[model samples]
Target: MKRKYTAAAAVTVVATLSLAACSGGSSDQPSATADNKPVTLTMSTWNLANSPEFKTLADGFHAAHPNVTIELKDYDAAQYATLLTADLAAGTAPDILTMKNVTDMVTFASGGQLQDVSDVKLQSGIKGAASYKLDGKQYAIPYRIDGNVIYYNKDLFKAAGVPDPDGSWTWDDYTAAAEKLKTGLKTAGSAALPAYLHGWNALVQNFATAQVPASALKGDFGYMKPYYEQALKMQDGGLQLPFATVTANKTTYQAEFGKQQAAMEIMGTWYVATLLQQQAQGAADKFAWGMAPVPQRTSKTAGTSNTPITYGDPTGFAINVKTDQAKTAAAKQFLAYAESQEAALTLAKIGITPALTDDAVVKVYFGQSGIPSDDLTKFAWAKQKIDPQNPPSPKTATLNTVLSAMHSAIMTGSESIDKAISDAEAQYKNQVG
Candidate 1:
């Protein structure tokens, strides 16, 4: 899933931009028809880097709907929201666009830019329309499921005299192995993405004991406080390295993790396929790394369930309300086909977990070639934790800004954990309320 500044932060941006109107409506509504008239629908997305897979999906959609043409527009992660906001304001936004969370859907839905998709049944045959339902109405479909897993270097584990992690292992066992591995290696025991950037994982992992349930908010920050506290304890206990040390001068998560600089990296399963591809090309040895669930919390009252919870980042297509009705209906048809079983399978081959809820379809889709059977099983197992309704915080973007600064302070020993949390809470309240 594409991480925006969290829902907490995104809400702040929306609030900031609320001063201006973000969409326009045309008086003419084109009639829907099965006519073969050529029509083009513009679609916007944030993953230009994954152009090949996206183009494949687009082509598949076009093939299914011969009369509708899709114009794919790519935007960098940082530039997408700003450009999209501008487009919405000028009444020239794409007919379909990608959204990260409910806050995003609400932002556009409230602005009257998105068409009501509640009545459009998914052609993919997935159950539970609740995943796409927002405020009593449906506006988008769940396209992919993403989650974080403990990706360990198998070679490193064996070298450290630690046994490989089985699915049944507990957090204590994980920490024991990590500590043992850190003794002989130059690298730290394990590494995690910066807390602010990974607030979604933090929220999901701590959902049970959280002051607020994961479902209460449009994004996941309400449950992140305890998660960060756990990280701090782990850092003090030497079970994991400080974020600053691992991230220092590191431009990308893959670069650092790929070099074996960290024995374990908490990352999404989507990157597993890419890593496997790299390993095949001899970029790295056939390391015996495997994924396991995050460790359980120490206290029972803490309510941290080790159900192997992870973050789910589902990207879907949404129609712009400003578009002509004929184009809108055609766009919906294209979206339905794009989200079908065949298209979903094509996406799964490229490491995206198909959003279709049917186990049979998912099995057939991942049963194909290019991806390892073991990895496919792992992906399928992880998909059970997919929580499309619980997206990252809209305040995350702003939280990330604060987190970046706070992380610097913590690593430098310039600020205490209590101070950091207090400061972050203040900023979060300011942004959201």
Candidate 2:
């Protein structure tokens, strides 16, 4: 089903721009610097411009094309998304921009804001390309692929006499472990907490098989029911963070876990870097921790047509369709190199897992990187799998707001499940109409 989300995207453009027109030249065409004059191309991202990894990549781009200058439009991560949308609405979107995930890419693609790169080179063994495609057109240059994980305190599990998790672990196993941790564990602050929710949106994405419901505004949201029910079961049992408590604290789950207040959390692969840093520093609050595959559906929830699955996606750069031909060509070339195995190796050497699937390249990065405290990244290698993601309805940002509010209301005892779901669907219809 296709939806046109008008409110969240820039509605109409007085000027239509393409990164570079197809007629500009061959695919490998460089930006014109015919008079030996410098041509500068802008790349926008939430990453620190001077960070070692970015510096390495940028330096290599400049070194190879001495006539070209790379200007970084780095912004604070917290404000970058809002600023990016504002720039697009203002007709000042950069030549190349970093997108957070498939949702953000889909929003832009719906508005004809991203360049179609289906013609670009696709390297063998590179991964996660499908997550960034919309309507059969490639809208983003895929980079790193990340999957859901259960990051837990191993020492706490041992203290509670609960076994460490494995791939075979199911929802029943998770619930049992959480119950054990809740009853047996006490934090340094003398309060008892069983687990934390690292990300709410992740709860929406990490589960679901190929199924479509007749009336989910976007059929893609069909998976919301079982996952939400499972999470609520934990909340009702006092095994999950209270919505009121979490909102009052206003801190990341990482902060709560660092204080030894939580025994476990379900989060994505991005948290691995933080875990690596803590183990490397020998932080006192950091205890032995391990990673497990994100929980799978129990037999009770897995219908004959449904198979348990985890979600993985690419977060990377895309060319602005509005940029000039020369800059567009340059942007395409730069992304081409960045997605190569060579660039993947460079990204991985610094502990950033690349989207490349070469076993040799993956081994090089995971061999010593402290991603998992036990230095066992093999679990991650086996657990991670990427698939084509859903193209969110144009009203995604609005739908997310509605879903989140409804969930919070139900969790806090402010609304009944029947009332909340009905209200959410009604709002979805009215707002997305």
Candidate 3:
């Protein structure tokens, strides 16, 4: 499965853009229809055995066009960047490569490895589509959008007599709730911590940028100081696990929340599938949990009527530049099919958030078994404005690297918040300028 929490840590790859001598061959097989020729297109995916979205797209597209077959090439999810970089450099990459984020997409496009898919008919509701555009041409089409939300254990909240979040929560409200939960759980002799803040740079830095314009990230990250200060305060108060413990023990947000060790966790929508599957398989304790809108910076963007801002980079598909015309045509067809409403419904049934969302898609998504049926959960899931966690820019890779180190320094108390932010700004300016 794609653990989106760690997506911000993707390696920055600089590869040579040499064309491959050999390309995918088209076959005139018996399965070919009169209008469509028989062809097999190889697509790159990670954790193929667990990620059903890719299989669903491949199957759905193949059913529509019997002449084409999509063969998935799996890579290690954690080492996807390294493996894909090697493949691209060696001219062995699959015909269709999955663009995990805009940063890597920018890199691949800059290296001339991604073909322009500007003509692909994207659904009107597709999010983060503009981030895939490079030099006024579309290079990829987003298939899935995983926005951030706060998942809280409803049973834990009830047990502690703490009111459940109702979609209008500012950061102050969130912090107060955590403090109350900490005291209430301790008084009740429950071992669950108030919240779980995962040790990802994106958790703090990306949330800080959610309400700002994408251009604000270009040469400045001074906006991250307040978010970092709040995170450090939470860690100091023991409301959440410390960064050192989480990093040293390699603890995951899944185990922390699924095992009832934490009452609340702010994570991407992708966790819905994993949590539901884990509950059904008896890997997680049976608990009533619901997703609420992520806490806002202030009241201006908070409430059900207002769209809560969250951060997540859309996952898109791009055709390799080295592929032949027959395979390229087939790949484009697959990309268009991925943005269809039929594809949206298929993904919703499995709890994956598809890019093409509408009333019907929202209905199907909430209709799934084990999914939270509350109005608040539905509102949070359906009414979010997702911004690219890392916008597309040649300088983004360097900025991400510097900010990650800055996060570690601040959270671990090795450097003051101002000092860390200042250092990161200087480092980015020196490297990018």
Best by TM-score: 3
1-433 per-residue lDDT for model 3 (tens digits):
1374223232222121222221211121122334576787888887665677788777776666666767777777777878898899999999999987688799999999999999887778788798898889999999888889999999999888899998889888998999999999998889999999988898988888876433535657778777877887788998999999999999998899999999999999999988999999999889999999999999999999999999888888999999998788888877887777778888998888998778899999999999998999988888899888777877778877888899899999999988888888888888877
Candidate 1's residue-wise lDDT over 125-169, tens digit each? 453235455567788765655555666666776666666565544
What lDDT is obtained when candidate 2 is compared to the true structure?
0.63
Model 2 residue pairs with clashes: 20-325
In order of appearance, the predictions have TM-scores of 0.74, 0.79, 0.91
What tens digits encode model 2's per-residue C-alpha lDDT throughout 161-272? 6677655566767888888777777532336467776435435433543222222446234456676666778877888777677777775766667666778877666566
Query: Model 3: which residue pairs collide?
Result: none
Off by over 4 Å in 1: 1-32, 47-49, 100-103, 122-133, 184-226, 281-285, 297-307, 357-372, 375-381, 388-414, 430-433
Task: Give the worst 10-residue stretch by lDDT in candidate 2.
Answer: 1-10
